[model samples]
Target: MKNKTVAAWLAFVGGPLGLHRFYLHGMGDTLGWALPIPTALGLYGIQRVQQFGQDDQLSWVLIPLLGFTIAACALVAILYGLRQPQQWNARFNPQASADAPAGLTNWFTITAIAAALMVGAAVLMASLAYSFQHYFEYQIELAREISQ
Candidate 1:
């Protein structure tokens, strides 16, 4: 049986790899393995765009996919952290005795929750900033072209 704290921490730290899903649902969870595909592509696209230029159309697709994946992972981590102890135990540890340690009150669990929230918020804000910057820069370039 997986501990809630452990699973939540994994999701927060390595969610793109679906490590948390593997821990909770085991190797049979295809989604766990597939979640990283776009993340990898997106990262590669980012590198390509950085090396070449923003005109790299592939980077546009990949970066947005990566951003979406990050946001989804953050949401998953937050949901896992917020799950009720009883529900979590029932879902993930039904085979274990009811008296088994739930680990919900542990310091690690609290820390993971806090970290997920902070990281999620930061990533979300960064994505928004990047989007706005790109949009405004495009507009400025268009205005300059039109004025000329």
Candidate 2:
């Protein structure tokens, strides 16, 4: 059975790759296998953009997809951390004795939760800022054209 702390840490550290899902649910989890696809595309897109230029339009799509994936992973980590020990144990380690130690409140779990929240919030804010900037720039261009 997978330990909750280990699963939480894996989710926080490598959720984009579905590492936590794989750890808890095994390799059969398609979502876990699929989660890394966007990350890989995003990384390749980033390299291409850096080597060539922003003209690599694919990067525009890949980067945001990757960002969303990361934010989703962070959310998973937070949810895992916040899950009650009893529920987690019941779901993942039902065969284990009730007296078995549930590692929910450990330092590592706490750190993972905090890190996930911070990273998720930062990514969300950055995405919002980028959207607003582009929207305002378009508005400014429209206004200038109307004034002319």
Candidate 2 worst ten-residue window by lDDT: 96-105
Per-model lDDT: 0.80, 0.79
Q: Please give, for residues 33-93, the per-residue lDDT of candidate 1 as tens digits.
A: 9999988987998898889898665676677667767777877877887887777777888
User: Model 2: clashing residue pairs?
Assistant: none
CA shift of 77, model 1, Å: 1.8
Instruction: For residues 1-148, write the lDDT of model 2, one tens digit per residue.
Output: 6577788778878988999989999999999999999889867867877988865556666666677778888888888888887788788888876445663558888898999999988986775665556567667888999999
Candidate 2 positional error at 121, Å: 1.4
What is the Cα-based TM-score of model 2?
Answer: 0.82
Look at candidate 1 and tell me the lDDT of residue 79: 81
| Model 2 ranges off by over 4 Å | 131-148
Q: TM-score, each model?
A: 0.84, 0.82
lDDT of 2 at 92: 84
